[model samples]
Target: MINSFEVKETNEMIEKENLDVRTITMGISLLDCIDSDLDKLNENIYNKITRLAKNLVKVGNDIERSYGIPIVNKRISVTPIALVGGSACKTVEDFASIAKTLDQAAKDVGVNLIGGYSAIVSKGMTPAEELLIKSIPLALHTTERVCSSVNVGSTKVGINMDAVKLLGNIILEVANNSKDNDSAECMKLVVFCNAPDDNPFMAGAFHGVTEADAIINVGVSGPGVVKKALESVRGESFEVLCETIKKTAFKVTRVGQLVAKEASKALDIPFGIVDLSLAPTPAVGDSVADILCEIGLEYAGAPGTTAALALLNDQVKKGGIMASSYVGGLSGAFIPVSEDQGMINAVEAGAITIEKLEAMTCVCSVGLDMIAIPGDTKASTISGIIADEMAIGMINQKTTAARLIPAIGKKVGDKVEFGGLFGYAPVMPVNNYSCENFINRGGRIPAPVHSFKN
Candidate 1:
């Protein structure tokens, strides 16, 4: 239990910084559901999820109400289906059916997003993994809440160029197929490098084989809270700001640890990691970009913002590490352009650009998230963006991803609405450079020299 001083400090930080719990993710391992028969596989997946997650929402709600803080999303990430249903499926459509079943199960259990509709082909691709990857467009198009990811690279085995090549086409297909939803369905897809299995955030979360049969992880976000804490210290020295952010993050993460511990106890599932990402919502006051702006930038994406974010990201991790022994996932500030109102406003006002966002990815969580590019953009360009982001993750020994949607027929300055938490974005331009040579290298970019440390 946290002491009164800590709690008081956290509350004060919340009042001044706009901090709150971002998400409470429950991880349900579906590996046990794997069987020779597809029907049995489906039944097992549904039953295991239902049993493990039956009380997830209730526990989250109770925690939120009791703590007087918001638990914005109640999400579930299951084992990657390619691993679970690989031997059972004969066709891509079979995999699609499995995806549908998972989606329906999430709805039945009242969860918002059901992740792990994914394949890990970073080293090589299995037949089932190949089929599932091919079916992502159909699965994501047809299902309401199913999120998918394909891990194309990692530090140990490097990236599989074949898989990387396929993803370029896959994303385009998903974008074209879901055009009616403003390509919002594509928003549910993420391409990752060194992806964590126990992640709880949507579009990227997945239950890994190393997890327990069932576990509940909490992802707490409070960018507003962090920003509020920095407001009065605007004219302070950089070192002072770093210290302030660290102290503030300590309190914010403490709240998350307390809520996750209590919630896990109530659910009777072992406590999983506390993903300390500054996940933003479409809500006006809850924007991560707003937090950046409050830290002295006129808006997110202004010059000097990346340096500020780098310090903030590092300090948050330092504080969070002190606060919890189980801190994991993408534990940093998220700059999803669409979901964050401040980011959206920045893009619209020309204060931020795709190139600057790319640079910011060096020090932040996730990359090119919820960004809209011109529909006419070449597939090679999309692949370049992905490769660039993956390179950052691979080289930095950190988790980074790209969740870009090329809105068909939409160009720069045009607004694409995704509705709800998906939010809206003004289409941003990508460089006109041809990435054919870089992408065609057709082999893994070796892990960074730093990753070779014994």
Candidate 2:
């Protein structure tokens, strides 16, 4: 297994093609830290996080230095605050205070971000869960590094239209609260349908109750590597193109497996999954759209975009499964507009629209991600959009999420620059027609007939 040729190829992928591990996330369960006393609960949460994750960043750095693999970020995800604070958090303010404690613990440990300020109200909400949901805008507004998410629908339980309706207004409040930062606080929040238990990525990651106390999960990305491989097979048959993607993805995932094994051994934490997603950044040529273009599209929203995305997603999972036994999370191609420069270019060129992006999510890893819309768009319309995406995920049995940023005071043709990996996005136009009548209906959408499978 130790071959010079393979080592050289891996080195070239890193040095030339922007290949790197996106994140090495430590998932810590906070169930043991719960308390009935508000002050005691906050103290327990902060102390547990700091004590367990004190060596996270240092371990990541050591691994990167020793293996010459670029680990972009070290993150932590914990038990959803809704469950952990249920006994102690009697009010919305109590839940918001927990966010501050989580933020402080992250700062002390030197991680880039800490997730799990979230609720799982897929079918219904407990009073405490509802309070945590209400506190999201304030929690995110006050905290620097805490990320939040809510799972409002799933195949087993159906869509919670009441929670969906509430989230629309909550997201608007989050946008208004951080208007000075281009409404960047909205970027730290995600609304999901069919959310996974062990996602290592931000805004949607929570340590499920079923998981171990603490574990190591790594997210590895290489959109540039895929695009470059596709270029080598230009004008080839579909069979040939598919083969190249599968092989290249296998190699990329092997890199992730190496890093995950090394980090698990060093940190003495049980290794979780290696999420082999082709997650893009704002950097040049490192885009999921670029891979689509190399697959014979003029732009990302071209005629065959969905079919191309489906093919790429399938082959990625196929190859990734062969590389690692524990392949999980959103392990496919991520098509976020702001994070992928090619997608932003597509938007600026008038080649992509919100409707087209929604259609694309049926096949991509996430739904309508990192998109910026005008502030004037109504909350009902946002809820309507969430309902549509939830229906897609619920029926298809796939993980789908929405991370929309309604730029305050920004309209179509205006751009908001978030910089860094959170990139910049042009305010794409949203349909102005009112969906108020439909969104006002406060009830659940029953699960599909196919959900009755034993």
Candidate 3:
């Protein structure tokens, strides 16, 4: 029902505007893989992932060639390891071994990355979840192509301050573990509030307990396409600007819908949702901030930035939902300072700061993402940042996340190059005022009154 575009137009959009299916992620439920023995659990995970996703990369490549659409990544996600390994992983090392198995499976399957090496502790942590949290630095250090996420807050359950405080130190330790690579391991980790079950992106993607045994989810991104569409409506009325964005987003999501169907058919997996987001890359012209600039901001952190971002985000959802049969994940514009060249340029020009980025996150898809801070910043400060973002998501009842990288041995004046899609970020200064007392208070922040709905 969405075949309202000419083939030439779609190809032009892809050839010129940096449009691509960001990832074709297979969500494999590993609930049945649970076992009492650690070795058996690891073996189950590896065999199941390998068998179910064996053709994932090949199918993605086949679809890319068949349709001439670029599928940037072929990846996999499984049930959160915390629940799967609870009976088997009695020690931190036991959890780290699972990470190794995941890395090996991902390598063998030839996918870009494997997620769901994760824990969901939004309310409180079980003993097994606590061990997973403790093993993060070691697990990340010892493995490649494995991503980890922790959910520390939710609208119904409020903020988990105990888990939040613990992860603050774990984030720093994860960064320290990969300092030689500019702490790039931090790029593979995310701390979430209200994380979604079917998200196809990393490092926050996992097969939620509510999902089916196996499903195919597609992530499609095109900030460049949106930026180009806005250029045609320069100085137009706000209504016209909104309409143009919606139309462009519809087109983008349609592309993703097609790719999702083909991949599902090829892999014999059930079709999941299409996440059509304005997720940017480091390339010039492929930036969410650039779309904002075309929407009349001199820079992304300008005074009117948040309002502009809210408008863009709303219109994108409206159009994408119309095009796709199902739309989920964090389907809007992301504001990662490292991944968007426009954001990186804004940072270099001093047009954006961490505080302003936090404000922007209130309306954006993700929060305080891919931001780098000074190496010497206190862990309590990091906890304070997480608490603030989690509070925003909890009160607003929207999904939000923080992927802060404290680049070890780096300062505010210095920059870090992560290379490839992780890109690079100029270190931003964090507020030096201490919040140690606030962070040390080991209790949950109660959900706001608005969340009392039955």
Candidate 4:
């Protein structure tokens, strides 16, 4: 099954490039855990997660050893807790306790992060959902490995002003409470439109209602591989470069499909989606920004960078679509500022700015991720940033999210270190324009005009 050119590329990926499977997520549906009795519900939650994911870490390690490809993270995304636990609780604290239990379960199973402690309040918020939203600060602050998200808007229902309002305060509280960690807690939270279920990525994954009781999904990452593929044709035309990248992505996604199929068969779980995100680690050779730079941009924020990213995203999808029928998630390149070394270097070198990053998000996969801003940045300014990204997703009918950290005691040009996969970032400046009146409107922006097409 191996052709000469493809084998050569694969060898280059393993030897010179840091190509590897990023994550193998187990989507465990927790709907069956819901119960009228709080104690029974918690017991079911722990038992289900433990039973499904007890051997996940071992299996991932064994596969890595067998294939010589590193699996960066082992993660799980459960059904939205608000749906399962919302009706069982009356107080925010009660819901937070449930989050703590989930965190412990993740630790027990040897997974680094567990997602789906979230609510889909795009249309409206129920009492339990409201309580959970308000308790996110405490839950995320107290738990080490729990990731939370809220889908406050979607193409179908437009943006929810009430949910958006609460998120501003929630983000502020999460930041302020975790200020000792450079507001690292805020990094664990994401607000989005059209969030995906089988996303084997962190901070924004939730098991959708359409999924089976349990399934295995894989996230494949190889920015270095794609960049290396582009390097061979340095002076090639743009069309040639696009072809190279597309061919490389096809190979990478095929590897992902192979790995997911094998992992699913071994675990006796149904195979799920292959999230073809160019997820970068804090390692030396896994930079998503490096892909952009190698694609002929001086750095990720150069004048033509957005156009380059748009092309890259399209070609990647085109190749991946041919590779597998189960493609989903943010399947293009990621531009998380603090997570990629080249992005950190770009920000330090004055090649990228917050505004340009925001503009780039219009075309890229995720929006304004892991950006550090001045501690004194007003909550309203943060709200304005969220509103802007939400507007892009709402209008384009794509998924976009913001994860901005207001680092306490840090200013523009100052750096905040979050250690490990979170990497580091110099504070990026936000515009001084006031959005008080707009944010203060305190009412929904209403569903976009496109939503009425039905």
Which numbered prediction scores highest in lDDT against the true structure? 3
How well does candidate 2 match the true structure in TM-score terms?
0.99
How much is the lDDT of residue 393 in candidate 3?
Answer: 95
lDDT of each: 0.84, 0.93, 0.93, 0.87
Tell me, what's the RMSD of every candidate?
Answer: 1.9, 0.8, 1.0, 1.5
**Clash tally for model 1:** 8
As a TM-score, model 1 comes out at 0.95
Instruction: Kindly indicate the candidate among 2 and 4 with the higher TM-score.
Output: 2
When sorted by lDDT, best at the front, the candidate numbers are 3, 2, 4, 1
lDDT: worst 10-residue window of model 1:
10-19
In angstroms, the error of model 3 at 188 is 0.9
- Using lDDT as the measure, name the better of candidate 1 and candidate 2: 2
Q: List ranges where model 1 is wrong by over 4 Å.
A: 1-18, 449-451
Writing each residue's lDDT as its tens digit, candidate 1 over 1-454 gives 5687866776675665566776788888887789989999999988888887888888888977787777778889988999998989989889998998998889988988899999998888989999999999999988998999999887766767777878888889999997776777789999998899778788899989888988878888877777677776888888888888888778778888898899889998888888887878777777778767767788888888998789888998888888888998888989998888889888888999888998899899877798899888888788888988887778777787899999988888898998877789999989988987877777666666665667
Off by more than 4 A, model 3: 1-5
lDDT of 4 by residue, 1-454 (tens): 7587776767678778888888999999999899978788888999999999998899888888877777888999999999999767788888888898899999999998999999998888988898999999989988988999998888888777678777877888898998888888989999997787677888998898899999999999888888877889888898998898888889899889888988898888999899887887677878878888887888888999999889988998888888988999889989999999999989999999988998999998978899999988887888888888888888898899988898987889999999988988899999878987888887677777878988
* Lowest lDDT 10-residue stretch of candidate 3: 1-10
Candidate 1 CA-lDDT value: 0.84
